[model samples]
Target chain A: MNDFIRNLASDLLRLEINTIIKQNMSAEKIPSNKRVLLRKLADMYRETLIDYGIAKSADDPQLTAADAPKVLRWQFGGEFSFKEIALMASKGIEQLEQAIKNETDPLRLNVLNSRQKILQRICNQSYNVIGIFKLFRRDLAPDTLMQSNEHEEPAKQIHYVDKEHFNYLRYQRGELPLECIPFRSHQETAHWNNDLDWMHLNAADDLPFLPDMLAMIYKAYQIGTEQIVLQTVIQVEGDITSYITPQYINMPDNIKEVVMNVHNRAISLSTQFWNTLFSTVMNLAGKSFNQIFTRNRK
Target chain B: MTLHSIALLWKKTVNWTFVPVKGLQFARSLLKNGGHVVETSFVFGKASFTFKTVISFGDIVVFIPDPAGYYAQHQWHDLCQNPHWHACYQKYLQIHFEEIANYFHAIERQIAFWQNSISGFIGIVNIYPLYRALLLGEWFLLFFPIASALYIRFLGKVTARAIALQLWQIAKKWFIPKAALIAKILPKAG
Candidate 1:
């Protein structure tokens, strides 16, 4: 950690010097060679500054000690005081940093990098994991599932998985992550507007609606593009419906790229739809009002 | 001093309203005590500090809730929010979206970030460095263009909707060519 910070600081200092030179060069009459050297140095330095800050931040003893559990406790219900957790996290980070600084082997550096990743994950989880922790605090039947369709029983544990595992599971099914999928085909309760869905697709006018639609959906649902497999392009008119599933689409390359395009489209279409509504809703209402008033004038 | 008192002091000292001397000292003190002092506010001068304790780069952040400095720097942020003001010279997307699309775009980015981040924390990648880095990098990039896009998208959505509404109004007016009927349907263009 310390090594990373030191390196980062060095990098930042270099950048600062370069920036100073660049600004001066741009504004003042100066030697071109000197300016070029400064520019190069500055670029190098800028790259390292964030790393330096991260290193310096890690050097705080309390930061590393303050891991996810402490953060979870502190944030969920204020069960654990922040001051205490902050001190622990800071201290832990400091120790880790020291360990890295002391190590000489290249292999050890890899370990340090892995540790750094864990710390980062903890920090990121501090947000939603806190929410999950809050869920634990809720009073409910022990066996009850908060979101039932996804889980057969109340989750036994909020286990953390590696990214590889997550990717594997998601790729395996082309479905959103977690124990269960969230959506229920609400055809019985909700009106099946096959015409409307078709019209929405037609609005693209043979333009690749798939990519835009996928993008919009990805954004709307906040899932990875990979999570949604275009299973089948279903065309429905009147009572007859036909569609193609992923089983039919054969490709040598990874499917992730294909889905990303869909994700992009979904995002685009979803935004376009809502934007159309937001921009025009008021005017339509106003127009209706005018119509009533004009009739009175007649 | 009590921790609460220290935090208050730190907050007050952070302001540009305070002397530079005080700011320097405050940063130093926070570092000395193993606190990560983030210089997010630069309303006055260059904000920096030195670390006294050894902590990981990720560990040393002092997360304040609704830091006042951000509000103080609202004008600068407003520009950042509307990237087009500066981004146009930079040749980025500006003024070509429906208002709803923009709004949804922003919403979507935030949600995607959260999902990816949450998964990362849950050890979705098993705390692997490569995986974590990929996730972090993805999120870091979004801060700039994505945010700006979101704002632009919102404006575009609103403007497009308004235009569409106007067109609808015009069409409605013409459908019944009778002046009386037209007047009834079309509101006086205020």
Candidate 2:
């Protein structure tokens, strides 16, 4: 499938090609077949440029390096410090080691060593992974299990738009790449009665309430009448949700066809697009920098 | 000038900074010929540093805080995720959101942002005096009538909303439990 060509070596080539197209935009000069491809490519380039411009103009995400930790806290809604996770893991390992050292019993020693290995693995993973694990733990509220059974008709599935996560909409200045996912009526919470037709998605790795591949979907989203985002009809109201890994749903074939089709076209155009674009750039290379780039500036 | 003075200047710039003694130990210790060469202040080193904050939201930047090897040299960073490969338009809506919010004197959004943001909770928790002043329109309206008037005039439709939010907390602790109690006791017709 010809997905979009995203190689960095061709980035400059694309820019030069864009400049050539914009400056001497004579439709009659170019073949009609390539024009369609270039036109779509041009649109993508425009979006990238707009996003870059926004990023340049917006407030820096960090007020200070000190503020970085807090940003993660705000996103994930976990109140534990980084050291606590490390310390807890260390303590577990130490206890396990001591048990393994002292126990004359082979079976007990084997169990202790295995537990030690698990603790080591958890410790070895990166901060966000550990953070995600701790944040999504069911142990946060003991009464959750008890309460689940108490409700006969099932817990009131009011759209629990996590307030902490929602707050990110405010402080986020600059180019925050976001996507809108339209809610199916059935997927919504029971008491959810809001005028909002869509949910906003931020590309996140830890404890994804939405798909981690959500950002990738945004490209295909809003294409004609079809959406690129996965048509994930199911959202589990899980007690220990996304514990080890977040789950995903497959998009319909017709919708996914767009990605495949675009990918195939992009792949086919790879050599021809670059060779032509660079040849044009090389022709313009003899000119002064200002003259080469100035064509569209005016 | 003495090294003492230079150290003092360094402290002012990097206040509460770490003393990476081991990292820099070789520079002093390895310079074996120790001599008191009394010298006057001449620019030993000149550094021009400009700090700019770049906002990054929605981009996944996974920090490998403590790596197994060579973590001390400097923080290693790379573009964390694959780029999307489709024609997409990203209209930065936050800028518009901010313009509208500020124009309408909607401080609640700011308050929500601050309260949820880093070290922002501490400031908001001690906001009784600010709250009182805002309610009285001392800081926001009465004291700065011209600015206030312009804000109100520009936000003709949302001015009333602005005033309402200025007087109240969005989520008062007392209101939540009370609302919950009322909901539980009330008969439902669903």
- Winning model by DockQ: 1
Q: What is the per-residue lDDT of model 1 for residues B10-47, given as tens digits with 9 covering 90 to 100?
A: 88866433343343233222222211121221111222
What DockQ does every candidate get?
0.02, 0.01
* Candidate 1 lDDT score relative to the true structure: 0.30
Off by over 4 Å in 1: A1-72, A75-253, A279-283, A292-298, B1-190
Candidate 2: which docking quality band? Answer: incorrect
For all candidates in order, the CA lDDT equals: 0.30, 0.28
Best TM-score among the predictions, by candidate number: 1
Q: Model 2, range A1-298, lDDT digits (tens) per residue? A: 0111132222333211000001111112121122122223223322332232211111244333333321212111121222233344565577667778789986666556645654564344324333332333444433332343121232432232222333235324422221111112222211111111122112222222112212212211112111112111111122211111011123234323442332232223332333433444343333335443664487
TM-score of chain A of each: 0.21, 0.21
Off by over 4 Å in 2: A1-82, A126-298, B1-190
